[model samples]
Target: MSPYSPVAEPPPRVAARLRRPRRPRRGSALVRRAASPVALLVLWQLASATGVLSPDKLAPPAQILRAMVEEWHKGTLQAATGVSLQRVVIGFALGAVVAVVLAVVAGLSRIGDDTVDPPMQMLRTVPHLGLLPLLVLWLGIDEAPKIALIALGVTFPLYVNTVAGIRGVDRKLVETAGVLGLSWWGRLRHVVAPGALPSFLVGLRLSLGVAWLSLIVAEQINATSGIGYLVTDAASFGRTDVVVGGLIVYSLLGLATDAAVRLIERKALAWRLA
Candidate 1:
C-alpha cells in the first residue's frame, strides 16, 4: 500500500451556533408576583368603602398608606424604625457571636461539649418570653431588657443549627485532612466551615425572624419610641390606620431581612447549583 493511502482526513470543524437573545420577562414576572398583594389591597379598600369592614376595627389599605406617609413626614416613622433596627442589629450580633463560639468549642472538643451543651440545652427549654417580668426586674424597662429579649430569642435557633452543621461534617474529610498533616485550624478553614455554611445560613434566617418577633414583644413594654410604641399610642387614640401601618412596617422588615439572607445563601452556596 502506498504511504499516502493510509491517512484519513479528520472531519472539518464546525462553528458554534449563536444563542437566541433572551426575552425580558421581568415586568410580567413582577406583575404576577405582586398580583395577590395588590388584589388584597383592592379588596381592603372595597370592603372599607362599602362598610363591609369597619375602618376603626381594620384600617383600609388607603388609610394605612396615608398614615404611613404622615408618620414618615413627622419623623416618627424614621425615629421608631431607627430604634427598632438598632436593637435588632445589636442583639443579633451578640447572639450570633456567642452561638458560634459555643458551637465551635463544643464541636471541637468532648470536654467543651460536655461542659457547654447541657446548660445551653437546659436554658433552651425555658420560654424566653415568660422571662419578661424577670427581665424587667433584672434589667429594668430600659433598652437593656428589650435588647436582651431579642438576644435570647436569637440564640437558640442559631445554636441548634450551628451545632448540627458542625457535627454533620463528614468524618472522611476530617480524617483526610489529618492524614495530609493539616492543622486543626487549616482543616476547619478548608473543610468544616464550607460544609457547615448552608446550615449556618438557614439558622441566620430563622434567627432574624425570631429576632423581629422578640423585638415586637419587647418594644411593647414601656417602649418610648418604636413601631410597637407607635402601635400602642395609636391604639389608645383608636387610630387603626396607624396601628396597621406599624404592623405592615414590621412585616416588610421581616420579609426584607429574610430575602437578604436568602440572597447571601444563594451567593455563598452556589456550588450546590451544580
Candidate 2:
C-alpha cells in the first residue's frame, strides 16, 4: 500500500446511527417517579372533602397526618418506634448469624447438608405465626419469645437462599480456581462467595421483611409496649386515627429498612451492578 493513501469516511447517517441519547438526570427521574404518589394524595384529599368515604370509620388523610404530628410532638411515637426497631435489630442479627453459619456448614459438607437441609426445608413450609403459640409456651411471654419468633421467621429464607447460592456457584470457576493453585478457603472466599452474593442479598431483603412481620405479630401478643401494641391499643379504644398513624409509622420503618439494605447491597456488589 502507498504510504500517502487517503481513506473515505462513513456517511453522516451511519455515524449518527452509532450514537445513543444521554439518560435523563437523577433528579428528573425522581420527580417523574414521585408524581403518582402526589396525585394519589390530592385524590385522597378530594375524596375526604367530598364525603366519598365515611370519616368516622376511616379518618381523613389530613387527620392521620395531624395525629402523626401530635404523636411525634408527644415523643410517644419516637419511643415506640425505637423499641420496635431495637427488637427487630437484635432478632435480625441473631437470625442472620445463625443462618449464615448453618448455610456455610451445609454448603460445604455432604453430611452437614443431609443432616440440616431436610429439617430446614420442612420447617420453611410452616407459617411463622403458627409457631407463635409453641414459642410462647417454650420461651414465655417475655422478650425472649418475641425475639425467638422473629428469628425463626427470618432464618429459613436466608438459610435456604444462601445454601442455594453456594451450590449454584459455577463448577468451571471452581475448577479454574483449583488449577490456579487456590486453597479451599481461597476458592470459597474469592470465587464461591462473590458469585453467591446476589442471591444472598435477595435472601437478606426477604428475611428483613419477614423480621418486620414477625415483630408485628409478636408485639400484638399481650405486648405492653411497642408500635404494634400502640396500634392494637388504639384500635381497642376506638382511636382509629392513632391506629392509622401507627400503621403509617410501621410502613415508613419498613421502607427505611429496605432502603438501607438496598444501599448496602449496591455498595457491596458494585461489581455486579456494573
Candidate 3:
C-alpha cells in the first residue's frame, strides 16, 4: 500500500483510544449524586425559614433532626428501631424460606406446578391488607398477625422471580450437565442454583422493599411498639417533627437495606462481570 493510500487506517490502539468514552472522575460522580438531595434540603430549610412551609402541616428538616436527637436521648429511638428491625428480620426469613421452597417445588416438576401454582396465583391476586381483618380475628391483636402480614407481603415477589429464574435456565446447560454424568443433585447444585441466583437476588431486593412497606402497614394495626407506634403517638400529640423524623428513619432503613442487597448482588454475580 502507498503511504498516501486512503486504505491505510489508524493503528488498533489509536482506534481503541478514539472509541472509548470518557468516564467522570470518581469524586465528581459522588458529588453529582449528592448534589440533588443537598439542594432539596437547602430549599426546604429556606422555605421553612421564610414561613412558606407551615410547621403544623409539615415539620422543617431542622426541627425533625432536633426531634430525632431528643428521641435518641429519651431512648425511644433505639428501642423502636430494634423492635422494628426484629420484626422485619423474622418476617423476611419466614417469607424467603416459604417462597424458595414453593418456587423449587413448582419449577422442578409438572405435577408440583399443577398442584401448587394455581392456588398461589389466586392468593396473589387478593390484596394482602384485605386479609388483615381475618388475620386479626384468627391470630389476635399481637405479634403473630404483624409478622404474618409482613411475611405475606414478602412472599409473592420472591416466589414469582425464583420460579421464573428456574424455568428460564438454558436447556443446553441442563443437557450438558446430564452428558457430563452429573447426578440430579449435582446438576441442581452446579447449574440450576447458580443460573437461578440472579433472579432470586432480584426477588430478594424487591421482597425486602415490600417487607418494609408491610411492616409500616402492619404496625399501624394496633401496634404497641416499633417505629409505627412512635409515629402514631407523635401524630396523636400533633408532634409533626417527631412524625417526620420517624418517616425519615423508615426511608433511611429502606435505602440502607436496598444498598446492602445491591452489594450482595455485585459479589454474587461477579462471574458475570468476568
Candidate 4:
C-alpha cells in the first residue's frame, strides 16, 4: 500500500456526526399542521372586521361559530349530522361488500373478468351526478335514492384498486405457492390477501371521499335533513352565517372520516411497514 493515499478518513466523532440522521422538530405534528388553518381563520376575521370582505358575501368566522352553537343548542346540527352519518355508513358498507366481491371475482378468473369488467368499465364513466334525476325517478324522492347514489359513488374506486392489487400480486410468489402444494384457497389466504391490502386501503380512502361528495349532491334535492339541507335552507332564508357553518360542518366531518381511515390503515398495515 502507498504510504500517502489520495484521501484521508475523518475522525470517528466527525464521521459519526456526518452519518447521524437529523431528528424531526420536537412538537406534535398535528399542531404544526393546524397552524395554516388557524392563520387563515384569523385573516378571514380581520378582513370581515375591516370590511375588506363583506359579511353578506361570506360570514365572519365568529358569526359562523355562533350560528353553529345556536344550531347545536336547537338540536338541528346534531340531528342533521346524525342523519348524514347514518346514510354514509349504510351506503359505504353496502358498496364495500359489492366492490370486494366484484374485485375478487374479476381478479381471480378470466371468465369473471370478461363478464364483469366490461360492464363495470362502462358504468364507471357515467357521472354519478347525472344519475341523481334518474335515481329519483326510479326510487322516488326519498332516502332510498340518496343512499343509492352514495353507494354507487363509493363502489368504483374500490373495485378498481382491489382488482389491480390482486392482479399485481407477484406471479413468482403465486407459482412458488402452487409448487409448495398449497391449494387455491390457501394461496389466496396466505399470499394474495396481504399483497392486495395496501391498494384496497388506498381505494377505501378514495371511496370515503366519494361517499361524502355523493351525500352532498343527493341531499341537495328533496333533502329534509343533513348538512346540505341546512346550507340550502340557510341560502333560502339569506342566513350567511348558518350557510357558512353548515359548510364548515361538512368539511370537519370529511376530515374526521379521513382521519379514521388513516388510523385503520396504520393499525391494519403495520406489518407492511415493519
Candidate order by decreasing lDDT: 3, 4, 1, 2
Q: Write the per-residue lDDT of candidate 4 for residues 1-274, one digit (tens) a residue.
A: 1111212233234565788775688998899889999999999999999999887799899999999999999999999999999999998898999999999999999999999999999999988768999999999998999999999988998899899989999989999999999999999998899889878877887888888888988999999988889999999988899998887787778878877776787787787655
What's the CA error at residue 83 for candidate 2, in Å?
0.6
Per-model TM-score, in order, reads 0.87, 0.84, 0.88, 0.85
lDDT (0-100) at residue 96 of candidate 2? 95
Model 2 TM-score?
Answer: 0.84
lDDT of 3 by residue, 176-241 (tens): 999999999999999999999988887887888888888988888799999999999999988999
Q: To one decimal, what is the Cα RMSD in angstroms of model 2 from the true structure?
A: 12.2
Instruction: Give residue 268's lDDT in candidate 4 (0 to 100).
Output: 79
Q: Is candidate 2 or candidate 4 better by lDDT?
A: 4
Candidate 2, position 78, lDDT? 91
Cα lDDT listed for each candidate:
0.84, 0.83, 0.87, 0.86
What is the overall TM-score of model 4 with all chains considered together?
0.85
Candidate 3 accuracy as lDDT:
0.87
Per-candidate clash tally: 0, 0, 0, 0
lDDT of 1 by residue, 211-249 (tens): 888899998899998889999999999999999899888
Displacement of the residue 51 alpha carbon in candidate 1, Å = 2.2
